[model samples]
Target: MNTSKRLEQALKKLYTAFHHNKLNPECCKQCAVGNILDNTDNWKYLSDSHGALELNYIGKVHQALGRKFNGYTPLELLKIERVFLNACNYKLPLHYKNEKPKNPTDKDVLFNGLNEVVKFLCYLDNISNVMDYTKLFEFENDKPKYKLVFTN
Candidate 1:
C-alpha cells in the first residue's frame, strides 16, 4: 500500500523473472542486493551504460534474446528487457549514501518496503505483456547511437 512495500514487490518479481528467463550478463551483485534491500531500481545502469552499453553490448543482448522468442526481433525483446529491468530498479531508493532522510524512518522501514517489491513481482508474474519497447538506440552517421528507454 505504501512506497516501500511497492518497491519490494517490484524487486521480488524482477528477481523471479530473471531467474525464470534467461538474460545472462554479468551484473553488479552488490547493487542488485542494494536494490532488493533498498527497494530501488538499479537496472538502468545495464541498459544505459553512458553509451558504453550501446557501443559494446546491446547488440549481443538482442541477438541472444531473439533466439528465445519467435516473431520478435532482438530489438523488441531488448525494449522489453530494458523496461522490465528498469521497472525492477525504479524509485525504490531515493537516497544515496551520506544523504539524510527528510523524515525519520523506523528500523522496520526496510522490512515493510520488501512487501511492495513482492507485490510488484506478483503483478509482473501475472502480466502477459512484460514490456512494450526494446530498442533504445538510434543511428548517427551510420554508427550506433544511444537511445534512452523511459516508459515509466
Candidate 2:
C-alpha cells in the first residue's frame, strides 16, 4: 500500500482504539501529541491553556516537533494537519450553526482530544520509526511515568 493509505489505515485504528478508551490518560502527559491534547505545560501555550480537538491544536504539534527534532520543517506539519483535518471531517467551531455554543460534554471533549493525539502519534510513527509510544504510556499508579525513548 502507498504511504498515505497506510497512514489513513493507521489513523483509523488509532481512532477506534481511542473511541474504546484503550489508552492510559497519563500517556497524554508524556507524549508531544498528548501534551497538545491535554494542554500540558509543554504545549498549553499554543492553545492559550484550552485543550480541544480543533485543527488549531496541530500548531502545538508543529512547535513540539520543531523543538524536539532538529531538521523537522513546517511542510511536514502542514501535511500532518491536512490528514488530521480530513479524518475529523473538518470539524471546527465555524462549522457549527451558532457562532458559539455551550461547552462540549466532557466525554466529547476527551474523545476529540484523544483522537487528535492518537492521530498525531500515528503520524510521527509513520514518519520516523524511532518513537516507541507504547512504552510512553503509564496506567498503574505504582509505576513511574514512562520516559520517551527515541532510538535515533
Candidate 3:
C-alpha cells in the first residue's frame, strides 16, 4: 500500500482504539500513527497534554512534522485551538477512581474531535517531509518550545 493509504489505516485504528479506551501505545506499536499517539514512545512529548484531541496534540503534530508557528501572530492559533478543544469537550475532566462525574453533553464531542483530528493528521501526513520546523519558535533557555502555526 501507499504511504497515504497506510497512514489512513493507522489513523482509523487509533480512532477506534481511543473510543474503546484501548489507546495504549503497545497496541499500534508498529504503525506510524501509533508511534505518534504512543505516550510511552515516539511522540511521548504528547503526554504533557490530555487526550489525542487537545491543542497540545496539534502542537505535537506540528513539532513532529518539522513545522513551527508564525511567531508574529497568535490570532490564528487561538482560532484553531478553540475549534479543536470545543470538538473534544476538552474542558471536561476525566473521572478516575470514582471521582465526581461531570454531566454529559448532548453532543458527541469525542467523535467530532476525532473526525477533525484524523482529517488534520491526514493532511499533515501528506506533507510530512517538506515542513520547516525551524520557524516554530524563538528559543528560551535552549529548549525547543513550540509556538504553533495553525494550518488550513
**Candidate 2 lDDT score relative to the true structure:** 0.41
Q: Give the distance in Å from residue 40's predicted Cα in candidate 2 to where it truly belongs.
A: 4.0
Candidate 1 Cα outliers beyond 4 Å, as residue runs: 1-28, 31-45, 49-107, 127-152
Error of 3 at 89 (Å): 2.2
As for TM-score, the candidate ahead, 2 or 3, is 3
Worst 10 residues of 3 by lDDT: 70-79
Q: Candidate 1, which ten residues in sequence have the lowest lDDT sum?
A: 22-31
Q: What tens digits encode model 3's per-residue C-alpha lDDT throughout 74-125?
A: 2223332333444555442222332321422223544554555455554545
- Overall lDDT per candidate, in order of appearance: 0.36, 0.41, 0.41
Decide which is better by TM-score, 1 or 3.
3
lDDT of 3: 0.41
lDDT for each residue of candidate 1 in 28-68, tens digit (9 for 90 to 100): 32222323323223333334441122422655565566542
Q: Can you rank all candidates by TM-score, best first?
A: 3, 2, 1
